[model samples]
Target chain A: MSDALHDPGTGTPGPPATPVLSATGLTVRFGGRPALADVSLDFPRGRIVALIGPSGSGKTTLLRALCRMNELIPAAVTTGSVRFEGAELYAPEVDPAEVRRRIGVVLRESALFPGSIFHNVAFGPRASGFAGDLHALAEEVLAAVGLWAEVGGDLDLPASALSAGQRRRLCIARTLAVRPRVLLLDEPASALDPVAAARIESLIHSLAGDVAVVVATSDLRLAARVSDVTAHLDRGELVECGPTGTVFTNPRSKRTEAYLTGRIP
Target chain B: MTPLATRDLLGTACRLGAALTLTAAIALLGVLLVQALGVVDVGFLAGAPSRFASRAGVGPAIAGTLWLAVLTAALSFPVGIGAAVYFEEYAPRNRLAGLAGSALANMAGVPPVVFGVAGLALFVRGMGLGPTILAAGLTLAMLALPTVLVTSRTALREVPRGVRDAASALGATRWQVIRRQVLPAAGPGIVTGLTLALTRTVGAAAPLLVLGAPAFVTHAPRTPGDILTALPTQAFTWSTRTEADFAALAAGTAVTLLVLLLTVNLGALVLRRRLR
Candidate 1:
């Protein structure tokens, strides 16, 4: 329930103007159709930001654009600037591999690699050029996610053999292996039961302050409970931005209020 | 009509069709066998093929065919599978790669006789290797290359992308992904392609003629540079003989060739079963 779990690094805070991540007019067009239109936001370190909106609200598109993952899809055209740690992420010399390593992503589908749990957790660190004991690192990260006991003994088993909830936790553990500065998660607990969802929430709570955590979910209860800041998107637009309690308890926009009261998905 | 009666009628018709098809295949095999037995003596197979080979034994021809086939498979098998993996797994899904891949696949179906002329131009006269088993082997490699390449590509393509993505998501480079996940998963298909290409090369004669497989080798060719004598050329020579014994030799060569084909096919079957 506290941010003590992660080491957020040298308490040297940036200028009130120095953002951990800042985007400027990000636009992604797919076959002349606007998937994301001139999206821009600034995320600071030690923050838990919840991206909440109806399905197809371009939250995922925005997330993909941030990582430049949309370029992998043909007919995708992007025009934007994403600066992470004040370095241009889309610069010609900037390697996407490095970007992915520094900024871990967790998809709703749980991108669990088809291998043993040890290998799955070791993936990012290995890809990012981790030279130390990978097995120890995997064990440490799995323990951080409170899954070490369940998967520790069976670190050699296929990932597909895991239960759905365990696979989701393992996915979180896999991302944590890299020790990323910025974490992007989409619907991390939409598919889970209340108990599993609470565990994920606790993990997110523990991750805050050490890393910038961004979660996109339709669960208003989740958005209200865990996040510090809430950004509402509707039809590819950032409709509202404010403190989570303020946004949910006393929404400024009619749409946000309607959404908060279950008038919309 | 009663359900059982309709089922019985359908079953009866299916059985009749299957029986007829099986009988036709068996009869064809039987005819080939009878011709082989009637013309060739058991002595033809057992005796020193090199001594009576020009007239009776087919050791030289058998050796030639095996040499050419083995050399061709050895050269083409790795290259074909590598190309297939590159095209299917590593190549970007763009227009240029698509066009080039299709062009290569189409090249496989071109006539073997044409390949013979190509081999003559590329590996024979052009390279001035001049009728050596090496030249013939390379020609045979070129002839089988397209078939192996296409089959291997198809096999690699059939592998689920999920396995690849899963492996890659876990620190695997593109080549490592292909080696560990894609190739193993698609291995059976590769073996099937290899067997097919090897069989096709064994059955080919026109290319060996262009590449100049020797007709009267007195000794077994252990080296690629040695002039080789393959079964088809020996069979051709024997079939031209005025004596009945030479005709028997040709039939015996055919039987030996058939057995070799069956052996390769069985090996491929075992590999495919192991994959499952």
Candidate 2:
């Protein structure tokens, strides 16, 4: 097996505290065709883990499985345990909505609602029944994502008025408003220019000190640059995972080497 | 034929078909206007049906039609929109839901007279409402329900999946996501569909005829329990008469009906814009 290079000890981060989120023996199938097979990963608090792979290599499926987001698809069947703070997320008693609120996701698309800038940012907290002033909360999250200054504090401005880069940042800010313990971003910066992408990456770097972040991306360079740990997958199987430096410079498996060197799609 | 030549032919055919439809509609309108030129006036609008053609007025018929339209809308819209929301936003993708969806689609294509027959059995005779405005209104609402449900589902489906996913990802419950995002994004489309469905119901005559709407009534309906008389029935009664003057009065009633439908459509247009 290509997993001969998979050293379980090196693959897991030695965080001072228990992981904020982790997936064990996770297998996801859509219409009985496996998308991810027996994959395992950990996301400890205040750390960034980047999941990288070629197109349709189950990078997205893995990210969705981590937070129980795959349940939304009618044909998708996920088997395994995803734990948040040592509690099983897939248990019958667990509310998927509650799990989602605690673990926010920013999709590949901006996916802004048809509303003002403030509404988009305040949506999470308001939907969760925030008792505090929503305006103050909107301003706080917008500033956190570096959008307040650019928007000139016009909270009432329609979300569509913003540029593409600004809209992406607004999506991130929306997720942050919920104060999630873990953030899953699916190619959040893939649609942006290099400069805008750098801005997003820096924002993500700034956020790593508080929120555990998992980014799924095709951009190997991005995965190398932002992630503390990197996990690579190929054909629904995890080829290798370890510290970013080791995975990049000295991949243990030929598949990992082939993918990193652009030898395989 | 070559692919490019065939494409050009198809485009020309489509344009010709569209022009033909538009021309036919305008020509019909022109004919109605010419026939009703001298027959229609405030006096004609305010008078009741009579043995003397000049004395026949459509005031009571207009009122009945208005009442029927309002009742049909009140009965149909809430139920139809609610069913659509349940099917689109809440229902599981199971056999039952698939069966229900197909049932609604098939019902949308059912002849209006068929609904009238069912309505006669259910609301008219079975419910003991008699051939009153309430019975007619209930029948029309039934006729309109399937269209509204089908159109409403289409409108809800028009909303992008990304919007729902974005809201769901925020940890918003299904109800919250529907109320705050899905409904708002789909509001204009839903309103547009409702407007078209309502206009269709308002113009329907076969169902009313089958419901046994009175050919002539002495006064405008004062309540839902009052005897029913509508523009379509009045026009039908007049048009069926051998008198030339009654035929002219029928044309005038048709003109009035067209104007009323136009007004309703215009009002819905404004509502649609406001929703957007």
Candidate 3:
């Protein structure tokens, strides 16, 4: 498949190139029940791909599989090749920690640590032994996520003191502080109010030039608004993947059309 | 019966149990206080145990108790916490690990005197440490280890899996995730567990009695090498005497041990708050 999908910003096709990360024939099962089946996709750097499906359609599972995050579940069994920077992720010698560090994920709950804002934002860099000034890096990411102004530049304030939107932004800032090549977000705005969700959408859009972003979301509007390419999944199967406008306006598969038209989940 | 009526009955039963327990505790404390009034002075606290009740003090016993508490904490805390971490974090989900975990859970509930018997055989007869404070400390450490391990594991498990996942997603190694996230998140619970284990070991008389703690020592223990003597054993010895004065001294010794235990519990409470 070509890597060039219409750029969400300009609606112009980008140059085709080798993907920064690619998954081929990926299949994942939890205790003999398949969650994702033979899903193949490519994630090119500096582009955002949104995976849209109904609940239990395996969007979150696909995102976790990309970084081998599914391995954390004891019952999860995966078969397939996921290549990041041309190296097999499931190789016996490959360190999962390194893969995860290079390809970060933000879970739906935000999951900020019960500590100061600075502590939450700086956690990834500190864990990875980043040699740069942590304070400056934390400030930068917080500012990028638009949380620094809301927190009033008080990095030491307890993370729990922040509102729901601010906490989600802090989680994003934490992931960004690690400087990953690929960013996976699962329902980043699903749990927020409209205003907060809009803020998160803009913040995610602002990340397009810096990282290869994959978003797994149930919101079709969000996928169309922020993604260059959109992949539709249903019941552990990939139905269609193409430019966002094409996927929404002229879907090839009947399943995609039905779901898009609110005829079926 | 209706659900509301059942609930009311249960509440009344609980309230009655609490009242009975409170009344019993207060009665016991009142008796001890009345008896310990004149006998528990600074001179009585500092003086050595004597044949005469008026000249007796728990100085050596108090020193021995302190030493035992220190040694028990030093030996058990690290080993127990390490074993707990291994069981929770690193151990594979296999039959052997499951068996070992079950064994630890069972051991936590075993009587302290059982550990003392093992310690007597292992440290005293087998290792030739004798009935010294070292031997008693080692015995208490044995008594505390299982309790510490069980409680620490429980504390570690209480930390949300999300915390571990978040740390792991940041590229943290297993050890780094445990050290930075899991341990800090579980700190207060661990501290409370350690405090409970330490205090239980501190106040235990059965283990020391089983280890043959001497009733009378002329001087405070200069080192762990000295003969083992503690407030529990001292109080037990004094309480066994027919003299009324000796009974008063025993109550005073018990009162002193209670105060020391309260101090330890208060310190642990403050530490837990800070950690949280």
Q: lDDT: which candidate is best?
A: 3
DockQ-superior candidate, 1 or 2? 2
Task: Look at candidate 3 and give me any clashing residue pairs.
Answer: none
Top candidate (DockQ): 2
Per residue, candidate 3 scores C-alpha lDDT tens digits across A1-265 of: 1122112333443455867789999999997668999999988878999999899999999999998889988789999999876678888777788888888999875577889988887888887789899989988999999988888899999999988888888888999999888999999998789999999999999998789899999998999999999999999999999999999999999999999999954
Once superposed on the true structure, which residue ranges of model 2 sit more than 4 Å away at CA? A1-15, B1-19
Model 2: clashing residue pairs?
B47-B57
Could you give candidate 1's per-residue lDDT for residues A1-265 as a string of tens digits?
0122122434866665666777888888887768777778887777989999999888888776666556646678888898876777788776555566566677665456545787677766765568999878888888888888876566788887887777888888888787778888889888788888889999999988888998999888898898988989888778888888899888899988888888854
TM-score of model number 2: 0.93
**Cα misplacement distance, residue A122 of candidate 1 (Å):** 4.0
Relative to the real complex, the DockQ score for model 3 comes to 0.63
Residue pairs in steric clash, candidate 1? B39-B248
Question: What ranking emerges by TM-score with the best candidate at the front?
Answer: 3, 2, 1
**Which lDDT values do the candidates have, in the order given?**
0.77, 0.88, 0.90
CAPRI-style quality class for the chain A–B interface of candidate 2: medium
Query: What is the C-alpha lDDT profile of model 2 across A1-265, one tens digit per residue?
Result: 0132122444465456677788889899997669999998877678899998898889999888877788889889999888876678888877888888878888886478987998898888988888898888888889988999998999999999998889999999999999887899999789789989999999999999688999999999999999999999877788888989999999998889989999953
Taking all chains together, the TM-score of candidate 1 against the true structure is: 0.81
Best first by lDDT, ranked: 3, 2, 1
